[model samples]
Target chain A: MYVYLYDTFISEAKFQNTIARVETRLTDLGIAGKICRLSVLTSIEELVNDAVKNGAETIVAVGNDETVSKVIPLIADHKVSFGIIPIGKPSRLAQLLGIPEGDKACDVLSARVVTKLDLGKANQHYFLSRLEIPAGEYEIQLNGQYTARSLNPNQTITIYNFDSLAPGVVADRSNPRDGQLELIFSGGESAGLGRFFNKDSATESVFPIKKAQIQGLNQDQSVIADGYTIINTPVNVGVARSRLKMIVGKSRGF
Target chain B: MFTKDEKNSSESETIIGPSVQVEGNFNGEGNIIVEGQVSGSLKTKGDLRIGTNAKIKADIEARNIFNAGEIRGSTVIAKDKIELTKTAKVNSNVKASVISIEAGAIINGKVNMSQEAAEESQPLELQDKKEKNNRK
Candidate 1:
């Protein structure tokens, strides 16, 4: 059974046509199921719990990255296959998954090209992308053995599960299925004209880690997950679940 | 059912780019390329490349080492080979199966090759006995 969870913003009148077209296409493909709108009255956890109890084998997020990130932990816990029908703009997760926007996403979901991916968990929140934290405020201890700190205090340290967080940034070393995360430390000093002067300076440093602890976070420093949620530190992050089954298109970026 | 582009092949390699300073023991299971400052120690089971702009002050161990930087440490051990490029300035006791030093590279410490080190690893009393037997 497929149960679609639409984000609250989709309830606006501007998205009516897109939602209708998506439903029509889903019905035509014989993959249509119950659709639930996210609202302030009903909590997402309760809805997901009910869907699981009602025999929802596949839980699909019919919204954006924030919507998908919210339900990832529940889907992984229930051990159900997940799908996404990206609708609105800034659908970076869908772009990375190779799923097109609007009704076209229904085709990818119906095709059922499932792949298991690792999820990055910081504290309790599960994130599919990466964790970007301000550098020098924290020290990351990798695999509980060695520790790494920023030599430069003004940079940002990003622990990437999927490497495509920053578009056109193109640091392609992180593999989501390998059960390890890539800790990328890039100094902001080499941004505009500094790159010209520092010809020999390396722009990025990559570290592969199985487990890590971000310690020494102050009250002001926050770990941003997927560019939306502010995950508080000190953070304990690793592969919370290594086998998150999802429907992915052929052109998906791993 | 999905076949994403597998263009990026997996390489177990670490890059310590320039303008970064790393302290403590930096250990890896694969190849490592250093272009920065590593103060404590650097060890890897695979090949190690010290880039031209790198300034490392750490004891090093690896399978094969290619140094083109500055290393001021105690010991550098390589299981297979060690190649010092023209810009390398090393101050450590180096040991390897095979060693290559390029022009303009400066070495300020003792170097022990595989053959002499193999003989030196034997018990001293046994080595003296062997020397006596060889004289006869």
Candidate 2:
């Protein structure tokens, strides 16, 4: 069974046409199943659990990256295949998965090219992308063997699972299916004036880690996972190897 | 399965770039490339490469070493070859199966050329004590 999850933001007037087109396409392909529109009062855990209990073999996120983030960990935990239909802005996950926008995504999902991806677990939350932390007086312990800390505090410590920051600086260096994460210490510097600046990073180091403990030395710090979700410092990170069976396009960027 | 996009990247699993400084015991099984600064002890089962800009103060061990950096350490042991480039400067007792030193490379302390000599050589502290006795 296929259950399509729609985010609350998808109800805006801008996405009405897009939602209709996707539904029509899914029906046309005879692959349409239950549709669950997530609202403010909806319990995401209950909704996903109910879908799984009702025999949803595949859970597809019908909105943007936020929608995928909320649902992917659930379906992955339930051992169900996942898909994405990126509708609007802020859909970098779909882009990395090579799923096109709107109704075009339905065709790729119908092709059913499923691939396994590793999920990064930071404490309780599951993250598909990397985890970012400001490198400021922090101690990074990798595999509990050695500890690494930066002499310069004005940098970022990014632990990548599904390497989406494909800039040429640290390009094509991280692989999610390798059962290891790339812990990168880098500083992002912006060049240019005003809002037209571009962020360039010179990667300081790369460490392949199976387990990591990031602790702050000066004060408590913030750790951002997949961009928006923030976890406090002293975070324990481990790789959940091949945790997600995701439908991806042939042209997907890793 | 999706076709993978192949791009050239560093073959070394561990890379210490030019902008960071690492301390304490750092060891790994894979190849290591150091371009920055390191202190304490560094060891790897695979090959090690040090760039010209690197400054290292540690006990180092690897299968092979290609160094062009500046090292102030107690000992450096390589199971295979050790190549010190023209820009390299070492202040450590070094042992390897094969050793090559280019012009302008400065090497301090004793150098053991063969892997068999590693088993025959005395411990670092014992050698130091022997040298002191000879001076006396």
Candidate 3:
């Protein structure tokens, strides 16, 4: 199967750099001939139309969170599989997808295993991070640094260094049957500095939501979906079961 | 506050090496130098220097921007100064309060300074606003 590479962000030169690196890596892995790229499509609609017309089976989105967000909704309606190569800052979605930074990203492009993963929806849009309804603003001290900001409702919050809590948090909140959104409120003076500091699941949230429909969240609420901001308030969020066909890293284990 | 071995090591001034990447946004105030790769937005209140081989793809808000390497995104420098050295290669829009392009430096995109700032906002800046507006 041929892999279609898409560079949707600005800066064509950087896109060229990404293409060069991707091509080189694919060549090293003996798959260069299977890749094709179509950049500068004027708009996202054109980009997707071109991809479908090109007869591409899989789409590898290069760049960061914003780029991934642009394509997720489009591919969800189709049968094409999608992958990501994180090359921008705040690549929360890419980090969640298990993509490495820099040159190692090329290696990820070459290695692919397909799997079905859960997706979240807020109104008409799809999200890939933890959703926060009644979106409370919180600050986190990351790697000894502090980030003070309010989180938006229906946004995806990517959790790092909180691996122990991921499963419990996801299980309690994310429910395909109930159609509810999952949420976990956490953070402190430092990364891993939590209420359960002594316990193994200190940083994890045991609460899960199978289905949740929130109302009265204001009309203009802001949300961070995999680091991409969406400010559509008073929106309905629910779990979309097996909504995404992902070209995951071999070690992702679904 | 330096020992004998530490003093000797400082004298050689081994650069901050290369290939290392910072994957998150950063902010600071000082004469900082980056030698490897930085993949995020940076906001500095003082001089921001990029080393000869560094690769930075960021939306930078800083003072006294000096580049001797490659920048793949937009730069917004609010006053102080800006210098693109002989080996610099910038591929995107640059909106500086001040700018200096040395011999051999290459920029493939538009250069937006005090004059062009009104005409064009940086790509990353526009993207930020768009996302913010979408939330509204």
Candidate 4:
């Protein structure tokens, strides 16, 4: 199948060399010479233009999920299958697809099988992840560092914490019934608890939800989706119903 | 059904740094650690980790989401575990076989722990449902 490669040429000195190497490998694999257009982009607008102009039946996004995120909206309505040769820092979607690291992605692309999947919505915008509100008066230490705490809602006031700042305060408002969006909230106990204790709290309030109407938050709040951040708040996210056609390799048997 | 031993086994843990942000659906089969923010849906057969500063706003379908951070939206599928640490905060509905919440964790949402088939393992049920609907 003819494919278009959307390569995000990160201008970092090291990345320039890395991009060259990837191009060389593509040539060695015989993909560069035939069946693939290594579409390189320096800007989002250029990325869209190049992709539209290439007119390749399949789009093999060759960066991390962030790069793919840029193209998702462009291709959401178009009939195109997406393939990923993930080489970026973290390719969550690629990892999920079991697309191997480095050059091995060639094999994944070669053996990929197209399957239509559901897409999510965030306030009229189509995305893999929806909008989010931070926890109430919460502080967490990850990788031994404290960050993004100021944005968090203060939980000392129980009402503000539970009513306005919690993750799923909008379940009823952002329902996931259409079968695309999967609303999520993150609060529970640590992993070390025994099975019984875990069950109790999980059964209590604050697990996760399908839809909701969150209160007391807006665009100022940050949300993380797919692997991209800086999402506007007061966001309403849901499923887009039938929207994406993904090309999963044979190993997954999708 | 194939035995556990027959399945491909890998043990590399991926870390999504706090600076990174992903905005799309994610489905995978290996262990994932999220320190950054994620929006959209996540589904994996392996373990999932949410870093302290990480924020996610979407549906989650994974074997487990070891929460040390924050999440919002719905948890459509978590077959194994959904652990929330003291610093964890989540406000959303959850559908999981197992879940854990720590003393300081703040959670405000509904959680359903009904015994249900894993999404991938429900092919037979789906086929049957389709057949039944056709008959109807």
In order, candidate lDDTs are: 0.81, 0.82, 0.55, 0.54
The residue-by-residue lDDT of candidate 1 on A82-163, one tens digit each, is 9999878768888888888899989998889998899888888888888888554777787776666666665678888885
Show model 4 residue runs off by greater than 4 Å: A1-21, A24-30, A33-42, A129-132, A137-178, A188-199, A202-213, A250-254, B1-136
**lDDT by residue for model 3 over B1-136, one digit each (tens)?**
1112322222221112232344456666444455556666766776676767678787777777788888887654546667899988888777776678989999877766775554355678876887799999
TM-score of each: 0.88, 0.86, 0.46, 0.46
**Per-residue alpha-carbon lDDT of model 2 for A1-254, expressed as tens digits?**
99988889889999999899999999999899999889879988888999989999998988877777777667667789999999889588888888899999999999999999999999888899888886577888888777777655566788888755455434567777889888887764434451143221244578888988988777668798887788898899999999999999877876
**How would you order the candidates by DockQ, starting with the best?**
1, 2, 4, 3
TM-score of chain B of each: 0.78, 0.78, 0.67, 0.72
User: Model 3 - which docking category?
Assistant: incorrect
Model 3 has a DockQ score of: 0.01
- Model 2 residue B122 CA deviation (Å) reads 20
**Candidate 1 colliding pairs:** none
Q: Worst lDDT window (10 residues) for model 4 chain A?
A: A155-164
True contacts kept of each: 0.55, 0.62, 0.00, 0.00
What is the C-alpha DockQ of each candidate? 0.42, 0.37, 0.01, 0.03
lDDT of 3 by residue, A135-182 (tens): 343333222221222222222233221122254334223333333333
Over 4 Å off in model 1, which ranges? A165-171, A190-194, B1-12, B116-136
